[model samples]
Target: MIISKPNINKSRINICRENSQSLEDIQNQSSSSQNQTPIIDLTKAPELNYKYGRTSEIATLKQWILENHTRLITIYGLSGIGKTALTLKLISEITTQFDYIIYRSLDNLPKLITVKNELKQFLCQSLSKPLPEILDYFKSSRCLVIMDDLENIFQFGNFAGQYLTEYKDYSKFFQQIANSYHQSCVILISWEKPADIETLQSENQHTKTLHLQGLGEDAKAIFQEKDLKDDEKWEELITLYQGHPGWLNIITLAIKELFNGQVYQCLIDEDEVFLGDIEALLENHLERLSELEYHVINWLAR
Candidate 1:
């Protein structure tokens, strides 16, 4: 469970002020002319404390959004790879560009109707209206909607992108958004791609995908944060963990206490590498693996 980092620094506060309006203040406004002001709801988004090693990815995303104004994009990655952090940083910098900005997490297992209704109410558009009528708001306004943790609705113990029957409506909605003309963009962040998304996305269309990978050298900062020693062996440790930020942070505590901050000594002492509640991070994947997949992994382990 990722918690939003509080006590944001002065620079971050200044960023909000620089926009002249903030997502936190959106609820205070009851004015009918909200279309003119940038309205945002980022209450569910985790607060960003630090970001590292995603400069190239951020640049590519900005180019796609600013240069082409792509309508739909998906960001997928393993847990704790900083997908949410990246998106939060991206929006904080560019929040002023859109008239409406909405961020919601699918981790709570929200229903498709509930999501549609929430958008309708926020935009002050009519309920019980046709889908076209509701979507017209996007056609007329520059809205940016981000749905995070989309894999929550997908079935467990299955291949990537298999949605549960109840939540499958989300795929259809996304497909419609990609195919139809709209001035807005909707981004989905998940551990796996949705089955329907691949069918709709094309080179000619304003649809694309970004798959997040572990941080490379920037992972050294996690050790620096923990005050781990043996700077010479940091890369070796990082390579062992595939530069996964969460794994590095967790394993560092054990190394510092058990091996006196000597990363090389820790590596020599423990062959298995990462420890302490690490399996929790892979719970979703574990639950979904097929019998054949389990057999393959078990056979390879021997």
Candidate 2:
């Protein structure tokens, strides 16, 4: 379910239908009409099940891609902050404007050469001779390439965005995309902003970053979806969790099972916020922090 703020000048976007055709079907259609069709490869992307309240994010991204022509964009946030969902929603709205829409994931930390070859092969499939470089396709076509789970390339125990020694080449690839003149856009989605993003944004108008945050009142939909009780107390619950869709969804399950769907019961302890199942999610985020960063958080808690 998509929940957007009213009066936002956004085209009506139908959520990805549950029974939509498979990737092979779409690829076949593109093959039949190579010149007119947009080559789409979403084999590695996550299915957007329920997206809540990213209307402004979508509009800003659309403007960057369609108007300002941003070449590189990094969407970063805390774990479970809806980065993937927002991008999926944006793709749904703007897919028709591009000649190609490709989605790749760095979750397994593939090498730079591997990724380059995969993208090159996919983008060059219709050509008589494969292009010498990936940028050639970018120059010849309007493409939207999304690389998700970028944090996988970074060292987990290091400060955020520090690439592992072996994955350092990905930084150069991103630099090339931002510095070179191209009609395509590459969006990187991660839990932490890459180290080069700040420098790139300051130096290049085409390079941009969007730091995603929580959903606000619109997150009430998740609670409603779970059939939680005490409708009037949802605002308090949302505020307590900062309207994080992932965290809210987890908490709703806890309330349903533990408090018999009564939200107030979970909120009764004013001094303590009950994390319930969210503690495990928090642990995953903490595991990625550097020792110093982890200590700083501990100090803050004290």
lDDT of 2 by residue, 1-302 (tens): 22222121231121232324332233334344434456566656675554468888899999999999999999999888899888876776666577778889999989999999999987875589888999999999887899999999999888889999999999999999999999999999999999989998999999999999889988998987788999999999999999899899888999999999999999999999999778998898899999999999999989
| Tens-place lDDT digits, model 1, residues 153-174 | 9987777788898988887788
Q: What is the C-alpha RMSD of each candidate to the true structure, in Å?
A: 6.3, 6.8
Q: Tell me the deviation in Å of residue 2 in model 2.
A: 24
Best by TM-score: 2
For each of the candidates, give the backbone clash count: 1, 0
What TM-score would candidate 2 get against the native? Answer: 0.88
Q: lDDT of model 2 at residue 107?
A: 91
- The worst-scoring run of ten residues by lDDT in candidate 1 lies at 10-19
Q: Top model by lDDT, which number? A: 2
